[model samples]
Target: MKTRLSLFALLAAATLAGMTSPSALAWNTLNGQKPIVIAHRGASGYLPEHTLAAYTLAIQQGANFIEPDLVLTKDGQFIARHEPMLGGTTDVASRPEFAGYKTTKVVDGVATTDWFASDFTLAEIKQLRAIQPRANRDQSHNGLYEIPTLDEVITLAKTHGVGIYPETKHPTFHQGLGLAMEDALVARLHAAYGNDRDAPVFIQSFESANLRYLNTITNLKLVQLIDADDVNPDGSMSLVDPYRQPYDFIVAGDPRTFADLLTADGLAFIAGYADGVGPWKPYLVKTVADGVDRTGDGHLTINDRRVDGSTGVIEAAHAAGLEIHTWTFRNDASGYGFADPQAEMEYYFNLGVDGVFTDFPDTGVAALAAVPEPGTYALMLAGLGLVGAMARRRKA
Candidate 1:
């Protein structure tokens, strides 16, 4: 309500939705189910990533929290974008006006050239429209939508009774711009959502520094992302080595590896700041076979039976009262996302995950519903009937 948006402006925008939704979903309202399914960039598989249309459809599809990758414009307004580059998610390459914006130095140790969001003011970005990036993926959504602002996203999410999980993309870089990305994001979110600690919204990031800073700023829940180690022969050693000494802690400035966090010492340290750890899929369950250990693309196999690696990283995190949710669950052939959404949710649910990052929330919600036994269903049905009767009496 404290947003800069005018009443009539919001009212006009609400008119576009045609139907107003309830407030945020209460976790108690989950009625005992699998982890919440957050749409990865708002049903990105079906539409252009981070567009209002993509976010809209995801809410209708039963996503508990719609995800938005937050990037700031030159004018200091935040927008939903996977990366600062416009070449992949938008029509910047085709636009001559933005050809000047095409330049890159190095990102995360990789040198690449592309159109950057920081170079383009919000006005220039508005001139470009969104298109599906992958050729093998759906391109029907090409040129259908424009990028949306953080304010636009929060408004849309509130109107639809959906929660938004925004990741502070490249935090270290944004802070370099003097924007103070996390402060700007949390201030805006709190103004609108009223600062409930477990308000169905989770602010996440790959970098640990942002999460740690956010812990000092607001009451909102924060998530830390962990990646896989390609060369580690033993997962336990890889996991434990991080906490052996006074190691580099933050993904920013220090750039410590995942091995640091997996250790008992690392986990105990991390639990001080975060409510959960969102690890890459590979580290959670490792597929294994007879004698020789197998490893390749699609999935990582970490079997403790032969490898002597206990999934104790998760246990360690959990014993410290942290939720262990794995991420980037997609539906692509690349196996980057979840293949069987139901089975994946079930697996994570069995693993005792508190949340899941999925490209499709509809599938995840259905899977969550299926987990409760018949007795739970009967109780739910009775509760619904009683609520219906009470509503009828009130109307009479």
Candidate 2:
């Protein structure tokens, strides 16, 4: 079976072939003139996520930055994992030696019984091989790669001249385990790259307080990640749910939802402490339908969901002088109510998103290349006319 090129892929090829104006380059960001393509969990779609191999693959795919979601180990070492849970993304369950560590623990308020990363020392973690987190993805690479430490990920990025975008996954939860990710992250960054604002790094988190704390400690850029659960079904923001509010907000008894953080006042508050915001893609372009259970059975059914572009969140962020980088762009048609990854990316790009976190970096790169500048369509039309004339002459 032949593969069909995505719309963005065709656009990229045309742009490269001089069919579009030269100004139709990649999208611009606060980091640089070109839109940044962040490899979500390090080319996670190809290899085992958070592995050095995956990071290397993302770099090869032309990702401007590679993301590694950070979690703490038992011995207080910083390691890369989507979450502290080891069973889902590693072969820990198959090992008999670490079977004793299997127990239930509340992770970020949810009760998960697995071989938690916090329960294993850094040495113990090295013994286990990283596996594909999703069952649908290729499992051949599983057991072939090992979980990488933050230092290893940084070293890989440095060696390849790619930027590192590391997120402090479950910062409050890690702090409860006596392993404050902020301190470790700051110390590691300081030792390696110093307190340079322009350094090729961006530390991100879903929670707000830790980012505010890091603002006092380092000059490195910080991004605030927003989750889907932060928004209520009625289009209002919810603060009562733990997932909807920052853990610190809940701890301090503050009644504010993630939606509050996106307002002009809220963005001003974030601007006081952080460089940018990383919202879920839906926050920018939500699928709207009347009387339809978009969340039926707790999963978004693709039937009636239509991409009603721009929720004004991007404009609000840009107005606050804060860059916006949205998350988790995949080539598959599973969750994002759209068939074309290019269209989804282009929608965000047109909305002036500074960057995007995609599991497939190549797709993001292509989509960014497809975004045209002013007068690109005019040039495309002229090119098409010229091509038609040349074809007619050849036929005659």
Candidate 3:
């Protein structure tokens, strides 16, 4: 349980302290200030997801953390992408040669037919171009980017003075091929950032097996994604027939079960390995009536704090000694269920979730500044000089 981070990275991270996050300087400190500034898919609002250009721009935008959702290549190398398929987010289907790589599989209990990375090797994957997933977003930079490797991401972030928060996507599905994504990822992270679980970098996953395996591998701080399956008064990990087993067994005999994790005891067990929990948005504050979104708020909500304070999921997470963070925040019209970006974030802020994931950092940063203690902003500015000095010194 010993984690060690390089002093150089500490100085580099110092420049990112005092982010505009709601918690700001109240969160953990590394040598000084700096709230974790995670770039949602490499400043994705500005560029395509998982592209090196996107990651580079994020570092330039003063993001302390650059997120690269990890997927494995056919050769077992890890690359950044929101999912295994490249069709939706990248230009894959259009490619003539990769026609064979197109297929379908049930992912997270949902059927998806697209280009899967597991179907292609590293060489073939690099040949494809990444496109902006949202047409209404930005697309001017499309077709000019190449897929990047994990090492490439690390090296890029190192030069810009930042760390990556890599989430292991679909752990069990990938594990079926004897491909241990978490183990490989943690090993690489430790090799790159050293064996510091407390390092500025974070490794998170929706799968508890992924997180637990990471805990046993490296001291890197881990995070568990709490979704509908992770919660239930019955304390069942998952109602999905395959994921609800209670023994040291597998899903349809694959050697892992959703039931293996997600307990009051399971959450506690995870706390031993991770420092935070990224729960479903509804878990913290949602507006639901007969499973319908009533009133002005949307249906896919996470917490009910507008009135019932004790029933809020954020409070529950805090009671469990875990800071609450919710995922997939974006100001783009597609994600705003309440029909207003400002109002949406205001709802989350009122609920007291520790942090949020947003495609638009500027929007989130602005929202964070409006909160009570934006002490991290001061740290970020103070640290700015260091980052500039480093960037300049390197340039010189």
Candidate 4:
């Protein structure tokens, strides 16, 4: 009850202050502008992800941008999906009619068995409904929303006056299917937002070659996404097969791990082609699983880890003239070093990330609002320390 109350109190103050005044707080962001909150998969914490309903809810909750991960259909039309495979995030598993459509295929070197979107036409896809892939989230929203195409998602964002951050999921794999995404994506985005670099779009991909290729064809903003398998107990990133390097890196024999991309030279290479970098959050901050159980949760979890502050990736990216946006903050999951998810985001904001991709946009908005002014920075840090102390005392 105390933790819940503390969170609500912070959110209330944030919302009120945000409504009453224009922000005069100095930010350490690349452009010195307030960090943007991107609805990771459209208020995904509440609704089944990638539904128009989820996106609309996020816009209502004050998200500055909505994200749609794209995969191609059998007809080569782009559709919103986190992966080219459709089984986990849709009702395809329950539909007896599409049973024969399920098969195994290799995606990014991993053999995945499921119903691939490329096997289904847009019309057939319409017969399926979106589902919450994460079992821990709300399940009632399942079977209520239809999968939306890139055109429809673009229209939604344009109508609402919010930006769209679209990730071209598995570009090389899509190309192998003869559904090369870059040209189609460029043409569609150009038609929607024109050939302007300032368009409210940030095209992102994990593969370097595709991003470099996109740099030549389109003037729209692009972000290079950096990924790793996991984080080690000592706060170092873990690099393993498949997740270790970008699939394209393996194919092209680039021989650089995801961590290598965060190095000064790597960020410089990225700066040549991308306006920004989107790294998994672990790459930005240092959180150590030192067995302290800071949150007093009987068992140590990621939340119980110690927050040792920024790992300097943010500053490095900024120094490289690239904005850094880290991701996938969710209220129901992955708070990292803090038990309160909003506080976790606030910590990142204070550390000077340019943007955050969150499943709970309302929480993200509130966290941004709650970030302290320069004079109040110490006060916020003190409050965070007090919370940790209280948790430890409770455990004692």
Candidate 5:
């Protein structure tokens, strides 16, 4: 309900704020202008996530960056996947060749019985096709696309002039399996870009140890990914909570949670090793409980789910000279914990966020276009006039 303003009105407001001028904006670590829209797993809302098709679609939709969650194969080949578990996102279960790989393994202290990526070679992984992981999303595209390697993803990004946001998924777990991710990642990146700080890439990780290691090796920017469940309401590490406590912390016997990393001192420390923080959106703005709905029907609904904007994380990160790039923006009505995706994005834009990770890159692009910088409105008007002239000429 908050995003009631027309697109033209938003553009006008942005123009008034001098956002149309390149000089008015400070460059982020990516060397790009602010309010960047990163395609989360490559237009994932429309296609099977982490596939070449998805990444290409995101580039076509004008996303500045495409995200790839990196997991390694048994041969130490880096691949794009949401997790090491292949059951949910890939058609591995149906592949009889990989049926033996379907066994229980403790990933980050949780027992998961699926075809793990580490158990299969890259050739074996190529036999499987990516599928839509979410039941609510379109499943028709399942089996149409193969899972892509990190090298393949990087190639696509370079070819299209788009950026790459690669997250080292479960680094500590991968290291335990005798496959350290950071060195491989660094080698690939160095071979391609050669220590270029502004090479349109951001290496991210949930655990600090790997990111810190990467910091020592690569000049490329690093992002620290924070999880919501990692901390309690009282800001203590909630190890009992399933996604709490980074595995590196657990391994090192450190009791700190993701919340500890967001403190002023924490951010200052991160600035020494990392360039930005990619936090879950709630860390920036939180949805408050207003009431509960008891309808005549058996179905129940949340009466109020409006976001209380600007939680100071953005300001704090900026104060520490660390960019704030929040994650998991979906255009769906329910998932984002806000009224609508546009409202949610607008809230962050208002908070001066450096960038966003969105499953719907088109929506993100359109949302940013709505609040166009100073010269954008003039271009839009010129394009409209040209269209009108063409229409009149055609009639003649």
Candidate 6:
């Protein structure tokens, strides 16, 4: 069985040999550049996330960037974990000795009862190990990797010559805990990569104020992440409670929802403080529940939703001079009318997303490779002719 990747490589190689113009295969991205593949939580689909091993694997997998969601520790140090909560992504729950650290605190308005990273010192944190939070993912590597600090993740990114897309997870919550990460994160990033706007670093945040604050302190690229709770059956986004608005918005009594950020006015507002916008994939494309099994997999699922095409967010962002990077493309779990994860990514890439945050970097890479660059239709037609000729020869 010839893999799709192998097939794409053959066609692409054949197409490239006769190409005269370098711009023949220009991408549809904001700057006509190839879309970047950011390894979300460091190739998270294949490994326990946020460990040095995971980060290293992501770099090895040809990711343009490795993402590390940053949270602070008790001693004012930045570490890579999905959130401050250690119960889900680490072995802290099983370690009886450090059991006293378990407690309840409201994180981004939800009362979360778990072992938080902020309660543990950097030295204490080292004793704990990483685990696969998702029950559906591989679990054999659960106790094998240690939780890595932000410095370690940065070092790995620099060594591999890849970019770092670090999200400041729950900035408002971290600030209230007296473990504010923005200042320390900026200072450390500036020290390592400098304050250059073109540095191989993009600091992302769900909170607007923190990114606005970051803009004044550093010139490194900042992305305002737009998030939503869920997608309604009618293809509308569910803007419920905490996930409805940036947590900081709730704190400041702002009434705008995450969906509002995609408006021309909202994008123009974002362009003031950030270089890019990272909306959840659903925000960029429209999908509708039309009662048809698009994938024909028995029952209708989110994957069976009818894809209606771009919702104009990408074009709007580009119009505002903001790059669009969407999130959480997983092979095991694809959403919104996409059964094939690679094909799903290709669709987004075709729609001109500047980057994609995927757990499987290799799939993302392969998908990007499969996209027909601008002016490549002639080459594809030729490749198809070549395939037909080969088939006829084999038949003879």
- Cα displacement (Å) at residue 93, model 6: 1.1
The weakest ten consecutive residues by lDDT in model 3 span 302-311
Model 6 C-alpha lDDT per residue in residues 1-396, reported as the tens digit of each score: 235434555666656764545446677778888899999999999999999988888888899999999998999889999888999998898999989989999998899899999999999999998999899999999899888998899888888899999999999999898777778899999999989998999999999999999999999999999999998777788999888989999999999889998899999999999999999999988887888988787987776788888999999999999999999899999867887999999999988899999999999999999988676674775576567556656766
Native-referenced Cα lDDT, model 2: 0.81
What is candidate 4's lDDT per residue for 1-396, written digit by digit as tens? Answer: 566646645644564455323333357789878899999989999999999999999999999999999999999999999999998899999999999999998998889999999999999999999999998888998999999999999999999999999999999998888999999999999999999998899999988899999999999999999998877756678899878988899998889999999999999999999999999998988877788877676887666788888999999999999999999898887656777899989999989999999999999999998986542543454466567557656876
- The residue ranges of model 5 lying beyond 4 angstroms of the native Cα positions read 1-32, 230-240, 286-303, 333-337, 372-396
Model 4 regions lying over 4 Å from their true place? 1-25, 288-291, 297-303, 373-396
Q: Residue 347 of candidate 4: its Cα lDDT?
A: 92
TM-score winner between 2 and 4, please give it: 4
After TM-score superposition, what is the CA distance of residue 112 in candidate 4 from its true location, in Å? 1.2
Candidate 2 total steric clashes: 1
The runs of at least 3 residues in candidate 6 whose Cα sits more than 4 Å from the true structure, single-residue gaps closed, are 1-25, 295-298, 375-396
Model 3 per-residue lDDT at 36: 45
Cα shift from native, residue 134, model 1 (Å): 2.5
lDDT of 1 at 72: 84
All candidates: TM-score: 0.75, 0.83, 0.72, 0.87, 0.83, 0.89
lDDT per residue (tens digit) for residues 319-350 in model 3: 56776567667676422234555456556765
- Candidate 6 deviation (Cα RMSD): 6.9
User: In model 2, what are the clashing residue pairs, if there are any?
Assistant: 27-35
> Which digits, one per residue and each the tens of the lDDT, describe model 2 over residues 266-326?
8998999999998877678766655455445555554346667778888788788788999
Superposed by TM-score, candidate 3 places the C-alpha of residue 327 at a distance from the truth, in angstroms, of 1.4
Compared with the true structure, model 6 gives a TM-score of: 0.89
Q: Write one digit per residue (lDDT tens) for candidate 5, span 131-173.
A: 9988989999999999899899989999999999999999988
Clashing pairs in 1: 239-263, 242-260, 286-301, 286-302, 287-301, 330-337, 330-338
